[model samples]
Target: MQNNEELKLALLIASIAMLMMAFFVISFVMYYQKKRFEEEKKISDIEKNYNRLLLDTALNSEETERRRIAQDLHDDIGTMLSLTKLSLNQLSKMIGTTGDEKEDQIMKKSQSLVEETILHVRRITRDLVPTTLERFGLLEAIEEFIDKLEEDNNLVISFQANTEEFPRQGQKLELTLYRIMQELVNNAIKHASCSRIEISLESTEEMIGLRVTDNGVGFDPEKIKENNLAGLGLLGIESRLAIVNGTVQYEKPLNGGSSAFAQIPVMPIAENKPEPLHPFRRERVNI
Candidate 1:
């Protein structure tokens, strides 16, 4: 009886020791996994910040170059063309039609060509750098752009804002939004084959939203992802929105067509603070 009792006690002690060992091993594994996960997340966050910095630098450089080119076109090429036109006018006046029909026609044609070239240069300059956007604000700039488009194309484009007196967001936010709008409109016109487009801009205390709806052939998001049918336009839109910490979504309206809505979180600018020169330099809000 004594031997049996001693054997039972030994077995129980051994079992308890094995359980304690198993518990320690599991605890160590779990702790190591948690630490490893935390390290990976830290590394990932660092990489994202680095990439964002690079993107901001690249975009800022591009905008600066664009502004430079626009200025040159306006100051140099545009001025030179105007002067040539003036000179032609003087030459025509001095000659006063010497009964040379061919020469008269040639002079008239030369003046017309110069005027046309000047108009083209002005249009290109406006496209490269939207002066109206800088001077007036986003709403006015967009209205002017849409009006011009309507005049030039057979399509009907309508724009509506939440208010007549839309408040100004900073220059960077405004420009980024303007560019995104331009891209959306261009894409709709080129790809959607829509006769009419409706664009609405809404601003609230927390966020600013833009919605573009068109009655045309819509697209499949999955197919676009698989086949890359979106081309660079979609990518450009994404990048611009990313810079502003905004998001865009596409939906197929039940009536037949597609709509794109983009939202950017708004941060109220301090009344006394000056707007930053670079739009990308503004504080970002994670969506």
Candidate 2:
């Protein structure tokens, strides 16, 4: 009887030990799974934050563009149209006068005003979205833009490129890159006070790169990093670049100027690419 009691006691102890081992294994697995889930959640949160930033930047950019267009219409074309209307009213008053040289001159002046107003409207429309960019491609469009700026005789711009046979990378990429370049040029003209500017484009097997250098007062990239919202132009560039999986670097060159370099990695193009963005097609959502 004593031997049997000892045997039963030993069996009970072994069973209890096995159960405890199983419990420990389960606890370990649960702990590991919890850690993995937390890591995934962290990554998800980071992505969401980045996407929100992009959306906000885009909205701000759209608002800025709308204000610029409105100002152009009100200050430029609107004023001219008003003056032309006044000229027309005067011309109407003297229409019945006989062989008056002054009346003839007024009519001619009115015609000239109408023509000038039409030209101004066309120029504003072109700036909103260049037809050359839509049809001839990015390089030609940039060349034409530079040529127009040259006509103003305010600054000298030089363009160098290896883009004669550049492949179509879809409209989003093209438009984003073009806008970045345009913003950089505007900054140089408005802030840099640079006399000479250089723009270059190069392509490789997997990427396209653009560099813009100016001989002007250089900027501190650190300031942009610290306060991105300080300059809408820079913020807009970064957000647009993020959308296309591109990157930009800004530096104050040792030779006394500012330089910006951008690289856009190429992805496999779909057989059916989306249509290029058109000025009229874009919605101007007001904030």
Candidate 3:
């Protein structure tokens, strides 16, 4: 009887030990999972904050650009037009019942000024938003932009479109994509000092790709992330891509230049979808 009691006690102790071991193993797993979740949450929060900052920067930059353009129109082109009108009004008062040679000369000069002002207004409007992109399509708009750039100087831009038609990514996507290319071209002109630029548009089953290659000194992606003075262009590109669910890759070739490749994923446009409300929409706010 004593032996049987001892045997039973030993078995019970062993079982209790196994049970404690199992409990500890489960507790450790739970703790590990909780820790992992916390870490992931922190990462997610960081991303959200970064994106928020990017959006704010983009919006502010856009507002500044718009204001500058508006001021140019009001102060420069608008002033010229107003002066032309004043000149015509003064000339009309000087006109007598008979034609004068001096009057004819003044009229011709005023007409020339009017023509010059019209051309300037058209150029400014085109720069603000290309009418070709809206009316004709992206391809034509790009070609026109490149032609204008080439006309200005040695900024030789070679453009090729692999597809005949652009993917149906909605108007907003089209405009955003155009703006991205526009910004890239301006950056290449102002900062890169690139003489030769090659642009290619390609479409795949998954996404649309835009590649701009410039024969100029390359830039460091790290410097862009660090927000250096020379990296504002890259920063703008980053902000644009973030908003559009796009990706950008920058590479430097052995020939000593930079290449920028941007890819935008194809998203299906929902039918009869309501327009998204802008979060920062306001009637007027004094800055």
Query: Mind sharing the TM-score for model 3?
Result: 0.69
**C-alpha positional error of residue 49 in candidate 2 after TM-score superposition, expressed in Å:** 9.1
Candidate 2, position 246, lDDT: 85
lDDT of 3 by residue, 1-287 (tens): 99999999999999999999999999999999999999999999899878867685666466446545655675677777878777776776667445787887777777777867867776675676455765666788899999988987787899998988865555445556777898888887877888899999887878888898888877876666577654666777777677668898877777977888999887666565323222122322111
Deviating ranges (above 4 Å) for candidate 2: 1-97, 227-229, 273-287
Off by over 4 Å in 3: 1-22, 31-115, 220-230, 270-287
Give candidate 3's error at residue 161 in angstroms. 0.7
lDDT of each residue in 1-287, candidate 2, tens digit only: 99999999999999999999999999989999999999999999899778967675775576448546755665677677877777776775667376677777777777787767766776676776665776777888889889988987588999988867777665555666678889999899888889999999888879888899999998888886887534888877877777667899998999988999989887666566444434444444322
Q: How close is candidate 1 to the true structure, as a TM-score?
A: 0.86
Give the Cα error of residue 210 in candidate 3, in Å.
Answer: 0.7
Error of 1 at 4 (Å): 11
Q: What's the CA error at residue 114 for candidate 1, in Å?
A: 0.7
Error of 3 at 152 (Å): 2.8
